[model samples]
Target: MNTDLMINRGIIKYNGNAFEEIDDVIANEYPLTIIVDGDEFATMVCTPDHLDELVIGFLASEGIIRAIEDIAALSINEDRGFAYVELVQKQTMSKDFFSKRFIGSCCGKSRQFYLHNDVKTAKTFMKQIEISVSQCFNLMTKMQEQSTAFQLTGGLHNASLCTKDQVLLSRSDIGRHNALDKIYGYCLKNKLSITDMMIAFSGRISSEVLLKVSKIGVGIVLSKSAPTTLAVNLANDLGITAIGFVRGQSLNVYSHPERIVS
Candidate 1:
């Protein structure tokens, strides 16, 4: 098994001419293939730590499984980084399953693999989680402090999910989406309730991200960057809260302002 490694790079100057050598930490990347009922679903380049959770979360985000219990068994080939999942009962895989192989996005959610129906049911829940701007900054600070990889390599993106009490889980990878998938998988495997949580990403809020959060029933999403217009529109239509450009003590609420407390 490969362990986390630290690498030393050249020097960089901060505040003055004084320079210091930088050291970074990162995990190894491996190809993880997901096979459902003996058929290939999707393959991702991810850290090999959470193959089972990644598979379960990927399936759930894709709308392949309605509930976490719908999955019966998940086997991971640690050596090969392959996962084979067996559902409790077989349901027809999406017709566009093959399409996922080609359509890749920078972050975790893929528009090419979206369901035809709109997320109308998500609009009914009027409950919103109010968080202060400083709290958003604090959460980001916590996320940054938890990112051992970025502190070292500075090449990977990180994603985390947090509740009012604390941050539940975080994952880092070269692909932002893969990081988010890791968190999703973690929650599914641990049987955590996602309805009362908010997701945080180191990337922009695109329609795909909104779609994934809505699918998981997360009421709010916060990002350290901007959001696409489609994402804002979808969040409003689905009654989800979208916060973006979250850095320091500021954030923009692009949709569902009712979720934010003044």
Candidate 2:
């Protein structure tokens, strides 16, 4: 379905001059409530596009569902801010899913209060691709260049998971975390894995970004900015490689420097 809506507004100049009315691009935002097996899960405020992908990705990222086949059916009531997802019979949720809170923070930073010492790695040796500095530059440039919303509003962040061949999924939102979630959702609905995939973002590397990557077992993370201290520590702990300041042919390796050849 076409998700774009149109609005008309007068362009006001910095000099207090108003130009003729023009059509402007507008996306839809609404409250989305997710329901699992007749139980109310969580509600999020998001753009009204890709509802199926959003809910599935949200559950998978939260560790609520392990695989695409685990989801039986999903129905969305766009007018009611609700979605009902029925899981396949006999599937059980991990105990950790009940304890982890659904975070809507722009950075999706994992809460310190919820850190479990017992949490162990769910994946091993996620990526084996040999990447060069120029490849990193091309990826970021492509990710940024594909952000249509950011070009229109100048107020959006973008996230994408790409391969050596092409971009797999890319999303944009007013919040950086939301963009990343959208990309994750896209992957989950499509039954893709973060293993050996490169995640690129147009935001700062915070604990939240690290948590998102860690949850999906993504091997390498590239950002067109800087990372926080906590994010670095988490990346090191999770065996996930992180790269920041990914501009041109240079980047800063905050953790797991071995992943980047040059």
Candidate 3:
């Protein structure tokens, strides 16, 4: 068992009329408090692994920093589950900087952020990128195989940045949003071109998820699960290609089906 990412807990197993006491491995969830330039920012419930990337990604998704260079200094205290980050300029903080909200492992933004923005600020992705239907299935297969954490505990959500051929980066967390943020943060730090990439993840395609992908300027998103009605509408409005229910060789192209080659 990977202790850094999961923990062992005593449990009772029941199979039909048989029962047994045993220890089971479960994904660890910890509250990671992020402090930006000595001010208390927000706390996120996430898997303990990749604290740095989580912080950077969370900030980026919140519109706190635009590039990796914008981060002047960063340090994580695992003992306390806190991340201290300093930005190159204080002006980079969001207009709602002081409004602290407890972000759960499953969701990223607060309800207030969504209510205020109304998806109006989401970038309309105009990139002309086309992928074949076979490529979409292949990418989904790769994402499923690379998600070791989910396979181990069945409690983690996985996300990856991929090209038409392969997955470039992947991350897992208890929250779907955190997983996406980790990938975005990794790309930002490595100076990867997000506009040319697609995001594949193991979760439902919600409007919030679409918003995150749009914020990163990605035009395509693939998911193994279903998509909400609002998410499909948002994808059409944003000019994004959203594919859902990617199982084996089958998938539902909710919006922008023209991008998927036959």
Candidate 4:
């Protein structure tokens, strides 16, 4: 399915004086309702691609499932926009499950409250191998370069899990968190180690983003954006290195800067 919807638009460019009419391709927004064990879990408005990965990663982020093996059955119907999942173990969720997120160009952020499940599942990542300044720059560049969708629609967020040298897996979505989730699911499904890896993101690092990073158990995150105060504090508490504003030649390291060198 072609997820880009081309439409006519009159838009202005950055530092431009006038608007011009042109054909524009916008990333399609689809509502996908995830049903877990016959129960409606969440309805995520997202780019209609990688539904399976999105579902898996969402569940994991919510502290519902840990590994791909934890899912006994899973099916996605993109046309109807539904994901049916059966967990291997009996599942339980708080009564306030409705408080869960419906976040980005979508709702735009995860739930503000830190739930008990998040506390139980979110890990304080251990020390990782040193990442140099140049390595961080290279990783962000590589992640952005791989974001073909963002380049096309200029409407998607990109995320990647990377070793110091290169990106291991990358994903992009209308929602920044969703893109990160896809990368998380990819790493889990591939049995890749999360602790030593870093995430390269194309969005601001908020508390929600930091929580996702904590849950994903990555020690370092690099973004060509900024981080919130709460997120920086959380990163410090969790022993995670949060780097942001990774443009051209300089970057800001928010917390746990020991893991970065040069």
lDDT tens per residue, model 2, 1-262: 2343222335634545755545555554567888788867677877666667777767776656777878888888877889998988633554446565444333543333233311422333345566667777888888888887766666567788887545778876665666667777777667675657778888998877777776666778889899998788767766777889988767888877776765
lDDT of 4 by residue, 1-262 (tens): 2554222355645448766656566777888999889988788888777778888888899878888999999998877989999989868665365354432241322333456567656788876578999999999999888887778788888889898998888887888889878877877777776657889999999988998988888889899999998888778877889999999999999999888899
State in Å the error of residue 94, model 2: 12
Runs off by more than 4 Å, candidate 3: 91-121
TM-score for each of the candidates = 0.78, 0.80, 0.88, 0.86
**In candidate 1, which residue ranges exceed 4 Å CA deviation?**
1-27, 94-114, 117-125
- Tens digits of per-residue lDDT, candidate 3, 1-262, equal 6676789899999978999998888999999888888887888899987777788877777767778999999999999988999989985436474344433343532322343333333678887899998999999999999988788899998899899999988888898888888887887887877757899989999988987788777899999999897788778878899999999878999999889898
* Full-model lDDT for every candidate: 0.70, 0.70, 0.82, 0.81
- Full-model lDDT, candidate 4: 0.81
Pairs clashing in candidate 3? 105-175
- Comparing 2 and 4 on TM-score, the stronger one: 4
Question: Which residue window of length 10 is worst by lDDT in model 4?
Answer: 103-112
Q: Model 4 RMSD to the real structure? A: 5.9
Clashing pairs in 4: 104-108
Question: What's the true lDDT of residue 85 in model 1?
Answer: 84
Error of 3 at 171 (Å): 0.5
| Best first by TM-score, ranked | 3, 4, 2, 1
Instruction: Give candidate 3's whole-model lDDT.
Output: 0.82
The alpha-carbon deviation from the true structure for residue 52 of candidate 2, after best TM-score superposition, in angstroms, is 0.8
